[model samples]
Target: MIHGCRAIKRADCFHSKGHRNPCRSSSNPYMILFGAVEIAFSQIPDFDQIWWLSIVAAAMSFTYATIGLSLGIAQTVANGGFRGSLTGVSVAAGVSPAQKVWRSLQAFGDISFAYSYAYILIEIQDTIRAPPPSEAAVMKRATMVSVATTTFFYMMCGCLGYAAFGAAAPDNLLTGFGFYEPFWLLDVANAAIVVHLVGAYQVFVQPLFAFVEARAAARWPGSRFLAREVRVGPFALSVFRLTWRTAFVCLTTVAAMLLPFFGDVVGLLGAISFWPLTVYFPVEMYIKQHGVRRWSTRWVCLQTLSAACFLVSVAGAVGSTAGVVGAVKLHRPFSGY
Candidate 1:
């Protein structure tokens, strides 16, 4: 099944790149870079061991959540109470109903951005064992549990952090805690985040590797470089793979060095991709797959919801773009951390 899928993907890649070798197509630098990064990361020992790395990543995530929740609650208590902390927090004396609604929509959009991987579950399903139709059911339950747990932590952190710092809350809750004081704890939390992202970076990039490699194999079927492999002690490595992957990693590393403001870029990407990937595509696919009546009450409601989500996504994209532009203007390119 996997081989068949790869064949189809290779064909698609070849068609998209025309008669020219995909590896030689300089037009799609982003695709090449993305593929290279994925392959490069895949070769890393930690990331290659998925189960062990996932456990470590989960531990780091839990540690950060626990620390954030505890500190937020403690700070809120020290501020007298939630009510007391809310005092003198608002910059505006009055806001119109429309403005309030807009703010609420923006908040929803921001939070919903985190749920944009709904379609990726389908990709994950391919990894499930054969002859178990219940795999989908199991995955659904697991997803629900995961989402519930994440939501609980996020709500606790956001509410308690706001109760503690109110309008003065830093964009990153951890940053609100003075870096120099409680320095060890801060260092640990930051280290955990870095560790988590290392694993996450590979997970996100693997599909790109598959996409690119399949195309390259199809385009250069007779190339000896693609077929040739060299033994490196315990591991058998391909020179073609190594060269492209290293180049890809270099490209990404250079880009990161040039623009290190991670949060802004993440917000911009979330805003731009969130609606189509998460809300609209899944809902539409589900409705169609289930043979639901077009424009029926339930279908209409779902469609309406998708439309609303699209609007929210658009608003978020505009807001994030503006924020990026403002930050760029203030700091200038390559000036921000």
Candidate 2:
């Protein structure tokens, strides 16, 4: 969202001023504004209730992605041919061989992060009613469709963006200021991103909210702070939920302010969470649930897949951590990157 806001601002500035003016700005204010919006949304009870928000989020996701893809295609056409090399960013004067290797590994983290929706698959599956078709079947179809569509857009946008900008491509395709002429369109794309992220933030954190609140209620079953609700106008509001969720949002907001390097943070998070949440746990659970014979062909294949993903996760973590360290050394906390 901070990036989105920055992009919008940059677009506006570049439109008014010349492109060479270097219209820099701070992301802290936008970060705070986003936090404030999230605090309000956090009050909503859980996943089942925010179906509309999820729908809107999905739509906004498509809106911005389409805009970005279109822009990339246009830029590539203007260039008259594809630009980037298959090996990726070249070994320039400032870029060392080790740095290039780390960046290549970091790209794995980015790809893993892009497909990390598996973390919430079961939560989504739980929302379906018992069916003429079983919940498993519904989820299987849904997973396949969602993953395929997402992968398609990811590949199109990534490949096109690379073709357009080559080694100079920005970490964020839209916010990277690649297309400066279409100012209003850029603004719309960034605005859509902000909207998309607003809902996405809540979607991702709701599980954590539920987990913490559930544990609190279990630990102190009789406490009013944990269990009591007060009427706020026509709505029933839980005191504990409000307080705890607010604190959690504030803490995370502060962390974001401290570490404002979006690319590195995202890569690091994807590296850290991808394997355990998306691969190992799910694969292990499937093997256990289905009673697959140990060391059988099926089991071996699954184990091999898990092992490969684990290695990717490790390499990604190392590269992303290096990126973060390098960023921190170059810039101070709470300062604009």
Candidate 3:
């Protein structure tokens, strides 16, 4: 959300002051605004209620992605060919050999972040209604389709973005001033990102809200504060949910304000969650649910895959942590890069 705001502000600034002007924007206001918006949306009863939001988010995602891909293609064509080398950003480009290695490892975390959504798969699956086909079958097919589509877009955006800008590519293609001439289009892309994130924030945090509320309701079954909901126009407002979700949003907002290195934070989270949430637990659950025999070929293969993913995740964590450390050294708290 902060990055989206920055991009929007940059677009406006660049439009008024020309692209060559060094336009700097702070992320504090946007972060607070995002938190406020989320706090209001958090009141929506549960995961099932946010179906429209998820759809809008998906559309916004594709909107920005398509715009970015088109822009990259245009830039590449203008350049007359691909600009990057297979060797990637060279040491001669002022990057040290060790920095190169850390970045390479960090790329794993970014990719992991891109593909990792298993944490919310169960929540999403729960929202699916029963039909002629089983929910499991529907979810399986949906997952496959989503993965294939995501992979295609990732490849296209990544390759084309690299081909266009080479080593000079911005950390964020849309916000990084990679394409400056199409100011209105950039604004639309950034707006789409903000809108997507607005919906996505609720989607991701709904599961967390559910878990906490469920546990609290179980512990204090008789407590009105935890279980009771009051009528408010068309919505039944829960005091407990309101307070808890609002506090969570505020806390996270403050955290974002303090550490605004979006890419580094994303990498760290991806690294931390990819192995356990996405790979290890899912693999174990599948084996347990299906009663796969220990040391059997299928079991061995799954275990091997989990082990390999764990190593990759660890490397990503280390690299991402290093990136965070370097960023912190260069930036003060609440300072937007």
Worst 10 residues of 1 by lDDT: 1-10
Better of 1 and 2 by TM-score: 2
Candidate 1 lDDT, 1-337, residue by residue in tens: 1111222333344445543533221213333343354555576533234656667767888887787788788777777887324333443636455544444444544675666666456645666677556877878887999899889998888888777777656556763331122445655665566566665666555556666778999999999998888888989877777777677766765565455445556666777778888888889888989988987998999999999888878877766665556567665444323
lDDT by residue (109-144, candidate 2, tens digit) is: 888888777778877887899987999999999889
Candidate achieving the largest lDDT: 3
What is the C-alpha lDDT profile of model 3 across 126-197, one tens digit per residue? 888887688899989999999999899888999899999999988878988888868899999999999999
Q: Residue 217 of model 3: what lDDT?
A: 86
Q: Regarding lDDT, does 1 or 2 come out ahead? A: 2
TM-score of each candidate structure, all chains considered together: 0.77, 0.97, 0.97
Local error of candidate 2 at 142, Å?
Answer: 0.8
Candidates in order: C-alpha RMSD to true structure:
13.6, 1.2, 1.3
Pairs that collide in candidate 3 are none
In Å, residue 113's CA in model 3 sits off its true spot by: 1.3
C-alpha displacement of 196 in model 1, angstroms? 0.7
lDDT of 2 at 312: 95
